[model samples]
Structures are given as structure tokens and as C-alpha cells.
Target: MSWQAIAKKDLQDSIRSRTLWATIGIFLALILLLSWLFTDGSGEGTFIAAAGFTFLIGVLFFIPMAGLLLSVKSIVRERNTGTINLLLSLPHTRGEMIVGKFVGRSVVMVVTVLAGFLPALLYIFVQVDEAGFTQLLTFLFALSVFGVMWVGIGIGLSALVNSETQATITGVVMFAVLILWPLIFEQAGIELPSFAQRFWLFVIFADLFFLPGRIADGDFTFPSVVEFDEVLLEELNDVAISVGPHLQMWFVVVLVAFWIILPIGIGYYRFSTTDL
Candidate 1:
């Protein structure tokens, strides 16, 4: 069998997972409920507003949780349970297994992101006056990339570890670094150089939440924290502007490429050399 066959099998397995379905169900329900609770009834630019709310909740909570849940144990579980031997008995190499698992799990995450954002799309399409389809599509594409990045981290962590426990601990640490560090930095008022702050924000997918309305409206701005105190938001804007070309949108490509490639590459390296 080839890596394609492994990817197909993994996809089928993920589709059958009750936990995956449950995560999707909860994400969809919460996004809709939050949209209802948070959406202003003024009906002016409601689509972007509602989508902003959904994206915030997803970025802060659901997307990371689901990504970790679906991928963090992928390779380690197979190794621990002796399925790795059976898989190797096939014609595929170990590299194919790692690639297949990452691709398969990444597909699962994309589907989860799509399902989670369907409610936001409902609001977007309903507000056709200001709801630029291009904007929504752009933000959704960015959101998918963010979610897939987490899947890569989880899969990489799984492959690097030898046990389920190690995977779990590493997953928690990864989540904290990716999801909580920015919040800590913002809340504690920690000082960093402007360029470093912008780079770190993008690293944690903060820019995706920070610019949802701009992204949904197709008017790009330097992304900053807009959900918090007005004064802090202004400060962030100033810093964002002062950083100039150091933190361009193209830098997002560089960071995403680094994150997606480094973890998987490291994990593949470890997996390739380790005795299975």
C-alpha cells in the first residue's frame, strides 16, 4: 500500500470517530449560540460582526482543542498498540506513514473548520449588502490554515514521543504556548519590541482574530488587539504602524511555513531513526 492508501484509511477512521463528531457538534452549537448572544440587532454590517464573534471563539478555544484531540495521539497510539509493525509490514515506508497521518489529520481539521464556520457563513450570506464573499472566503482560508498548523504541531508531537502520556503532556504545553501566551503578554502588560510583538501575535494565530472584521470587509489593516481596552488597542495600532515593513502580510507566509514544516520535519526525522 502507498501513502495515499494510508491517508484514505486515516480519513475514514477519523470520520468514524465519535469524539470527532462530538467536537464538531459542540463547536457548531457554540458558534451559533454565541453568534446569537453577541450579534447586535442593528443589522448594519451584521455579517462581519457575527463572523468576528465566531472566529474569536474558534481561535481562542474550539479550533485548538479539536486539532489537538484529533492528532496528538495519531502515531504514538499506533506504536504503543503494535499497529506500527502491521503497517510497516505493508509496502509503505515509515516516512509514508508519517506523511499520510499528517495529511489525513490535516484534512480532518479542515473539515472541522468548515463545519464550525458554516453558521458564520449563514450570517455572511444573509447580509449581502456588506458581506463581501471574497472577504469571508479570505478569512475562512486563513482560519483553515491556522487550524491545520495546530494539527501539524500535534502530529509532530505525537511522532516525537514514545508514549501516550508524553504526547498528552507535550500537547498541553503546546496549547498553552500557542493559545495562552499572547493573552498573558497582553494582560500582564509585558513589553516587547514592536516587530517581535507582531511576529509573536501572528505565530499564535492572534492576527486572524485581530483582523476578522477587516478581513471580512476586505479592508486590510495592521492587525491589533481590538477586543480589549480602547487605549491598549490604540497603543497596539501605533506599534503596528511604527514597525513598518518589518511585519508585512507576506511575513505571515514565512511564519506559517516555518510552523507547519519545522514540527513535522523534526518529528519525521525522529520517527525515521527510532526503532519501531
Candidate 2:
């Protein structure tokens, strides 16, 4: 069969898998639980905002992690279990195989996201006005983009690593680094020089999941994103001034797209060239 067929088979397999179903069930349960916990008894603006924020925080972080976990062993597991060899024996190129793996995992991720959140989204749309519905759409878009990026990341790691164990560790370590590096650097009092601040900011931007939390609080400025002193700002001023007013809207999206593509691009290069 072709790569599309392979992806379809994998998606069907995941649907039949008990673990996948259980994860989806638990995710749905969490949304229901958080919805009740955050919603006010009065069911007014307070309830809507609280419930929206609650689900946003829960889903934004959880989806990437779930996608990463689902994809962690996409290729490596097949390799470890000798299935990669079997797959290669079929009429498929290595590129087709890895691409199929990514597509399969991404379908699973998007399905998981929609299944978990669509119920709440529907409720929000029914209860809230047009502006709130627009905001919710924005939230969903961000979550989906972020989820796709992690799928690529997981597939990339799967292609690069030699074993399932290595892929697992690599995915977890990458997640931890993205989540904790900024806090760790700040807590350690390790101040980067002025010239390096913009580059550092760029590294931080690579973690798109970071933006949802900040966006939830209605803080969308650079200072809201990462802390910077006068010196660092002065150093990074050239970088910021270059982008100017255009930086606020679509610039963030380009960064997200970059993170999404870079890993898979690099990993596909490695996967295609290497013997499976």
C-alpha cells in the first residue's frame, strides 16, 4: 500500500488501541471536571470566563504533551520491534514511511483535541456572544497549531533516535527544557548580555505553548512574554525595531510554523539517508 494507506491503517489501529481510548476518555473527563470546578453557580460572565480560561490552560499544555507521547515511538518502536524491517520490505521508500508515521500521529492528535474540547466549545458558542465566540476560535486555532508542532517534534525525534528508549527520553527532555529553561535561567540569576537578549527571546518563542497562558491573562506585549532589563532591551532594540509594528500579529505565527517544520525537515533528511 501507499503512504496514505499506511497512515490510514495506523490511525485505525490507534482508534482500536485501549490506551488511546482510555487517554481520550480521561481527557474528556478532565474537561467536564474542570468545567464544573471553574464555572460559577450563577452562570453569567464570570462563569463563562472562568470556564474558558480553565479549559484553555488545561488543553494548551496537555495536547502537546499527549501528541508528543503518542508519537514518541512512531518509527523507533517499529525499529525496536523489527517491524521497521518488515515495513521496508514492502513497496515503500524510507521517506514515505516516516511521512506516514507523522501524518498518522497528527491525525490522532487532532482527533483527540477536537473530541476533548468541541463539547465545551459548542457550549461556549451557545452561551457567549459573537466576540467571545471569535476569541474561542482563536484559542482553538492556537491549540491546534501548537499540537501539530509537537507531533512534528515527536516524529522528528523518532526518526533521529536509534532506539525507543532514546526517543522517549529525548521527547521528555525536550519538553522539560522548553517548559523550564526560562524559569531556571531567571532563578539562577544568569543574566544574558544585551546583544544576546533578542536571540534568547527567539529561543523562548520557539515554545508556542508559552503564549496561550500569557494570552489567557490578556497580556500580549513583549514584556508580558519575557522579562528584560533596560540593558538587554537596549541591546535587543535593534532586533525589535526592525520588526516594528508588524511583530504583534502574524510574526508569532511564522515562528510557530518554523518550529513545526524545522524538526521534521531535519529528521526526514536523516531518515531518508539512513538505512532502516
Candidate 3:
């Protein structure tokens, strides 16, 4: 109940913040602009083109940025300004405070994601066939989860650090590690050890941006982005086979769960043990 109260307050604060509206405005503008560019005089392939474009630009970049922007400061700001002490002075425990902040900020991030993708969803429903509509829904669901994943990471970092600058820098570095490092390694033909390769595979699988292509290709293979050498592909396949049981849909869910929960759990521990 205390967490609920805290969550309500965070949601209200987000609603009042200009940053929220500004993000929504910019997201909508991007979605609309992409939709316009993808649309022809006739509506052929409009939805597909727009949706793919959105997933590439919107999901890959904008959603992560927004989630981090809204949440990376959630706990540290309160602590730095001595407001966390004020909050704890109420009926709230540290656990409730963290849960409430996560829930509230997660809601803001999810809502922003929906607002960003709604135009594409509408375009798909209006101009595309039923199959495309189904794909659009699936894409939206994946994007929403991806957005929440970043929010959890941001909240965790917020709670983990002592200051906004620390949180911001850590958030950026973490993002780059999870996103950029894998990309650079793959592009440069650099080979990681088996375990590291699997971790990167897990990251790409969790992002699920390739879901549409997977569906279209009718190839349900994990890490479907690989177009590398046959030997490397065979090696990766061997690794996947070694971890076969863990590569199931359930394992994917578990991986995602860890991404969202592990950081928050660690952050809560740190927050609880550290003095305000």
C-alpha cells in the first residue's frame, strides 16, 4: 500500500513533467514523419515499410533513450537532494520505495512506448491485411517489453549509484556494452569465446527486433542475424546445441526476467545497506 502511494506520486510527477510531453511529442513526430515517407499514393506496403523503419530507428534508439532519461535519476536524485530520507520517514520501507519507483517509472516508459508505436499500429490496421496486423501487434508487444527492460536497468542503476552523474555515466556505458560492443565485435569479425558469444546471442534474442524477419523467413532460429562464415556458424550452432535446453522460449523468458530483476535486486540491496 505504501508502494502504491509512492507509485501514484511518481506517475503524477511524470505527468506534470514537461520532459514526458516533450518525449511523446517528439516520438509522435518521428512516427508520423516515417509513416508519411513510407506511404505511397496507394497504400501498398506502407504498413510494412513504416513498421520496419520504426523498429529500426524507434525501438533501437529512441525507446532506450527515453527509458533511461526518465528513470536513470529516479532514486539518485532523491538521495542526492536528501528527499530519500524524507520519503523513508513516511510509512515506506526501502524495499517499497524501490518497487514503487520501478513500477511507476516502468509505467511511464511503457506508456511512452505505446504512444510512439500507435501510429504504426494504426497504419497497419488501416492499410495492411490481417496478417500484417497480427505482425504489428507482435512487434508492438516485443517493443514494449524491450522498453521496460531498459527502464528496469535504468532504475537499477539509479538505485545503485550515489549521484546523477554516476548513474548517467554508468547507464551510457552499460548501454554501449549491451548494444554497441556486440555490434562492433560482430562487424569487425572478431571472435569471442563461446560463453561471451552466447551472452551476445542472448542479448540480441532478447531485443527481438529481428522477430519480424524471423516470422517472414519462417526460420525460428535464435540469433538469426548471423550471416558469417560456415565454420563459425557451425561452431555457434554447436554452442546453441550444448545449451539447447536453455535456448527454449522458457529460457528466453528467464533471460529477460534476469535482465529486469537482477539489477533491481542488486540495487535494492545496495540501497538498503548504504546510508542515506
Candidate 4:
């Protein structure tokens, strides 16, 4: 079969599946609820920052879950249904098959993000005067990169594993590792003897997860104690700046490129070698 046919079939299967829509729905609901609770009617600059940051966290969790769910069965399910053999017998190369699957599923993820997040963003813009268009745009760009990486990782894991359960578990474990690794390292409290050492450490950790360490760095400014009122709607300005250590932008870009390419290369290698 042609690559176009393969892509069409995969896209149809995804649309017929309700799990994809369900996951996106849940994410949208969470974002709306959080916005209602945290956002004040005021149009302060900090309000935009808070909403954008909260939305970023929500998308981080949502994108990985969606990627894992959509991709965990891309190949294993075909094998289970005895369709893999027929597909492998086609004139298309293994690389074509793998690439077609990735493209099809990645398209689904992109649509999901646009559908679920775009309207929510519009609502925020209309309802909250504090919403900054620039910040929102930046958050969306970051989220797109994050989503693509997770989808690539999921496709790679699915291609490598034989069983659907194994693929699902592997995807979940990898997601957890990527998401939590930075926090784990930070909590471990490695003694940084010098500024150079600290900078390199940030770069190393950030590269592993494909996230800029600057985003994760905690507030460097003093005035450690934050009042309780600041935590509630009564005071939104009490949030402290958690910024100090940061990875260079170039380092993040390189890491993102590695995340997308390396897994896909391995998937192609495995697909090429596997017996039809």
C-alpha cells in the first residue's frame, strides 16, 4: 500500500476512537477550572503571568498523556489483529511504514492541542484583561515543542515493544522520568563548588528532559516568607520570582532536536531489522 493510504487509515482509526477526544476534553475542563479559581477580575500584568504559567503546567501533563495513549498501540495493536504481516508484505519500505505512523499520530496530537487549547485561550483573552498575547503565544510555542517530543518518544517505544501492555508501561515510565528528573536532581542538593559547575549541571539536566533550565530555576531573590493571603484570590502579587540558574537557549534547541531525531532513528533501525 502507498504511504498516503497508510496515513489515511491511521488517521481514520484515531478519529473513530473516542479516547483521544475524551483526553482532550478532560484537559480543557481542568484548564477552565483552574482559570476560574486562580484568575482575578483585575487586568494586572501578574495575572497574565500566573494564568500562562498555570496553563503551561496543565499542558505539560496533558500532552504527554495524550501522546502515550494515542501511540501505545500503533504497532502492537496491528500485530494483535494479524494485520502487520499483510502490511509488511506491501511494496512500501519499513521506513515508510514507521514514518507514516508517526506523521499520522503526530497530526492527531497537533489537532488535539489546537482544538482544546485555542478556544480556552480565546476565552481567557476575552474574559481576563490581564492576559498577555505575547506570553500566551510563547507558551503555545513551548507546548508545541513539548508535545512533539512526547509523541516521538511514544512512537519510538511503541515500535520497539511487542505487547501493548509493555508499550504502555514503557511510555509511562519514560514520561515520568522526563517530567520528574529535574525535580529529583534539584531535591538531591548536589553541592556546587563553583558557578561554572552549576551552569554545566543545569545544562546537563535540562538537556536530558529537553527543557530549558531557566524555566525550572527557582526564584533567586530574597524575602523567603510568602504570606497566606498571597496564596488566595485576595493577593495575587505575592508570588515570588524563582529565577537564577538557567540553561542557554541554544542548549534547549539542541536537546529538543536530539529528542525528536534519536528515538525516530532507533525506531527506523528496529523496524528495518525486524522479520516480517
Task: Give model 3's TM-score versus the native structure.
Answer: 0.80
lDDT of 3 by residue, 179-254 (tens): 7776788799998654354355235443354555555667554442333344376687775332343442234455
Best by TM-score: 1
lDDT of each: 0.75, 0.67, 0.74, 0.64
Mind giving the per-residue lDDT tens digits that candidate 4 earns over 1-276?
Answer: 566777788899889888988977887887777665555545444535555555656655777788777776787778777787888787877777777787788888877777767766666676666656665665555666667777777877777777888887888898787776656666898544322232232233223332332344652221111211232533456554342333233345555566767777887678678764
Q: Of the candidates shown, which would achieve the greatest lDDT relative to the real structure?
A: 1
Give the Å shift of residue 165 in candidate 1: 1.9
Q: Across residues 90-182, which tens digit of lDDT does each residue of candidate 2 receive?
A: 898887887888888888888887787767666655543443554565656656666776888888888888888899889989877756665
> Against the hidden true structure, what lDDT does model 2 obtain?
0.67
Task: Indicate the worst ten consecutive residues by lDDT in candidate 4.
Answer: 219-228
Error of 3 at 186 (Å): 2.1
Considering summed lDDT, which 10 consecutive residues are worst modelled in model 3?
A: 241-250
TM-score of each: 0.81, 0.74, 0.80, 0.74
Selected candidate, larger TM-score, 1 vs 2: 1
For each candidate in turn, give its C-alpha RMSD to the true structure in angstroms. Answer: 4.5, 6.1, 4.7, 8.4
